[model samples]
Target: MDEKKPSRMYFIGKKEDLIQAKRTTVTLDGRDILLLYHQRTFYAMDLQCYHAGSTLETGDMEEINSKLCIVCPKHKYKITLAEGEGLYKATNPTEKVPTPRWYSKGIKQRVHKVTEVDEDIFVSVSTCPVWIESDYYQSEKGRAELKKAQESGDAEADVNADEDV
Candidate 1:
């Protein structure tokens, strides 16, 4: 099977700075994103848990059945790295999980597309939580504004470096 690639990249941080099993939360374009690194793979998801809207940044990272899963701190719901369906089962195994005749899949969380370039972590803007309703970057004006902000941030970093010298 061929692996899927991210459509776009948004810089997160240096690869060396990310620690395994540590959750990082970042808000970009008014959308909250949760980042988790485990076994050299970076998983990106919405900050809100599917179960009860709990912040997944505070969830517990665990390795279950050789798969990386996040246990929601509020209800102990577990979500897997590949697919986010293990939560319901882990939390309530005694109850019969309802499923439609057409589909038997359990509750699943949306996983954002992530990519790493060199040492920098990037996430696809299309998969960003904010763009779910309507893509904020679809308009040329929005793209231009984002570009300007990135350029300004770069210039500011350069100025700071010069001041330190």
Candidate 2:
């Protein structure tokens, strides 16, 4: 079994200082998260908007129709800071990687939570759990057979032939 490395936590501003600070940006693992202190509680979220990767920290935080909307500086994309969902349901192609159409449909953005421990704040930076494929796919013979089927353009026939002979 492989051992997982624990995430390192850094101490930002104190609880008292956070209340006085309107909006403070903290860098964690090369990613920036804006910290907003409201009602004696601290809320932290991604500084960049998912729509066009616009910096959301500099945007105005106002209530529109009883909903908190963070207006994007680039395209004026109104995104809800509470729910982390963009107002307009538009699929903008990411500059980093092209996502499959099926996978991107009805996808909601995720906002990570920050926990206040003692006097310091901690954010979980662990990677997703690894999923293992089937035992056949893990074997060397299965890889060779898959390669042969791909090269010959007889994947279905090879799979069926292997079961019989």
- C-alpha RMSD by candidate, in order: 13.9, 16.2
Taken over the whole model, the C-alpha lDDT of each candidate is: 0.58, 0.52
Clashes (N, CA, C under 3 Å) per candidate? 0, 0
lDDT of 2 by residue, 55-136 (tens): 5667776555465666766556565555555554333476466543311112123344567866665554323233221223
| Model 1, span 1-165: residue lDDT tens | 113533556788887786643668876645567888877788887666554344578777887656678886756667776665543332344558853222213435656677888878887633423322112222454345445646777311111122210
Candidate 2: which stretches are off by over 4 Å? 1-8, 64-66, 89-110, 118-165
Model 1 has an lDDT value of 0.58
Superposition-based RMSD of candidate 1 using all C-alpha atoms, in angstroms: 13.9
Which model scores highest in lDDT?
1
Worst 10-residue lDDT window, candidate 1: 156-165
Residue-pair clashes, model 2: 0
Residue 94 in model 2: shift from native, Å?
A: 31
Off by over 4 Å in 1: 1-6, 90-107, 125-165
lDDT of 2 at 22: 63
> Residue 142 CA error for candidate 1 (Å)?
24
